[model samples]
Target chain A: NAGVTQTPKFRVLKTGQSMTLLCAQDMNHEYMYWYRQDPGMGLRLIHYSVGEGTTAKGEVPDGYNVSRLKKQNFLLGLESAAPSQTSVYFCASSSDSGKLLSYEQYFGPGTRLTVT
Target chain B: DQQVKQNSPSLSVQEGRISILNCDYTNSMFDYFLWYKKYPAEGPTFLISISSIKDKNEDGRFTVFLNKSAKHLSLHIVPSQPGDSAVYFCAASWGRSYKYIFGTGTRLKVLA
Candidate 1:
């Protein structure tokens, strides 16, 4: 069913460059999130959206911006890439608020971004 | 300040043995905890979860135990198989927050 899919599995960018990572989910989840994973560092939240047309800052949102214009799509943008931003980025979605349901996150394959 | 911590960076166990992975958290407000498994080049997948109201939750070969007093949680995999070799992450959340604090992750290698 293609639960969650991320475009551009791999990408490389020079310092100061910009790019966008696309995440699409077919589960029709209301919550979507962007996270980065680095060696010895667990997944850190970059940004998240509770629903369409809504976005909020997460744990580490310094160099990233996100948009959830559509219910099924969440876009994460790197305005200016930096060496510290080079890491594997993951997109996840959950059905609802962290209440009745356990809010289990379903993740995509992930996008590997390298900034030189 | 990392809230969720996985003390062990990696663990190796023989197949069919019980594998226990430990996790601790500094935040006392956390009410929900979960475990996720990840393979090389793939994203983390949810394995199981436990609520603060409960001390333990089990699903097939996986079990999660939460100790609120100590702010500790663990994932136990019984009869571990080679296929269980992967990175395991522990995450915690409080109330309605959509964000979860995740641990550094423990790489489990189940030797056959």
Candidate 2:
């Protein structure tokens, strides 16, 4: 299995530029999540989807948007890139079985985004 | 507020010794705890996990111990190898909640 894969392993964006990060998973997971890892802080959830077409705000959802148009794909968009938005982004997938904490997450390699 | 915390930023252990990484959580509602190992440029991989009901869970050379009273958990790797050097993250989550609160992560290095 390819597991989870993310696009644009590295990128540099100027302020005001827009871009999207793509995440694709072949594990057929029912849940998808987007998280950003900063220097001192742990990975913080930006947005998540329980399934396709559903998205919800996480701990740090500001300045970012996400869409799960397809089960195998999750897209994270930066409408207007800012310096503070620069961080290593990771995408994860899990198989939810309706039981609490029943699934373990599989993460992608990650995308390093630098906004100057 | 940081729900999960890993006080130690890094730890150094001699080869073939035991490496103990500690993690604490303030949320009593958390029913599950997990440990993830991450290499420098790679994503974190699930190492081991334990449920609230169980005080200890063991898998291979990795063991996870939970202390409910202290709200603390730990990951112990016995006979550590050089390949085991990596960043370790602790995560907590409650029933049916897909969101996991992660700790700042502790870097473990095994000295040869």
Candidate 3:
């Protein structure tokens, strides 16, 4: 089971250009998240979905949008890319929300984006 | 505000020795703490975790200790192996929150 997979391993976009990154998980997880990893900064959550069709903004959700149309798929979109958006994006999924049952999240390889 | 912080950017330990990585958080409300290891060009993988009710949790050679009063948490690796060398990050989450705040990350090197 490809625990989690991300599309477009690498991409380059100019300022104001738009693109979307897709994430798919075969584990049938109930929760999915999108995070950006920047130099000297660890993973910062941009958006997350507790269940299919439900989404929420995270710590650094500005300049980013997300949609969870299917249970296995989560999409992150950059409407107008900026130089600051250049970073590695990671997608993860978990069976539980760590409230009562704490489950470790499974992460995808990650997509490297460079916005010039 | 950087609620979670890993002060040591990097650390090196000799093979077969004990390696300790530290993390501190400013939020007392955080009850769940976790540790993750990441290699170059890859996503972070779960290492271990501990709830606030417990002070220590052990899994094989890796253990996590939490000091609620000091608001600090640490990961200890015994008999460190070269394969264990990687960037380690500490994360924290509060009640009913779906998000976790992660530390900057500490790079560990097990030297032979």
User: What's candidate 2's i-RMS value?
Assistant: 1.3
Q: For model 1 chain B, where is the 10-residue window of minimal lDDT?
A: B92-101
lDDT of each: 0.94, 0.94, 0.94
DockQ of 2: 0.73
Off by over 4 Å in 1: A97-102
Please report, as a residue range, the 10-residue window in candidate 2 chain B with the lowest summed lDDT. B92-101
Q: Write the per-residue lDDT of candidate 3 for residues B35-85, one digit (tens) a residue.
A: 999999899999999999899999999999999999999999998999999
lDDT of 2 by residue, B1-112 (tens): 8999999999999999999999999999999999999999899999998889899999999999999999999999998999999999999999878889999999999999
Give candidate 2 misplaced runs (Cα > 4 Å). Answer: A97-100
Better of 1 and 3 by DockQ: 1
Question: In model 2, what are the clashing residue pairs, if there are any?
Answer: A100-B96
Per-candidate clash tally: 0, 1, 0
- Superposed on all Cα atoms, the candidates' RMSDs to the truth, in angstroms, are 1.2, 1.0, 1.3
The alpha-carbon lDDT assigned to residue A103 of candidate 3 equals 57
**CAPRI quality band, candidate 1:** medium
Go through the candidates in order and give each one's DockQ: 0.73, 0.73, 0.65
- Residue B102 in model 3: lDDT: 93
lDDT of 1 by residue, A1-116 (tens): 99999999999999999999999999989999999999999999999999999999998999888889999999999999999998999999998653663588999999999999
Task: Give the Cα error of residue B8 in candidate 1, in Å.
Answer: 0.2
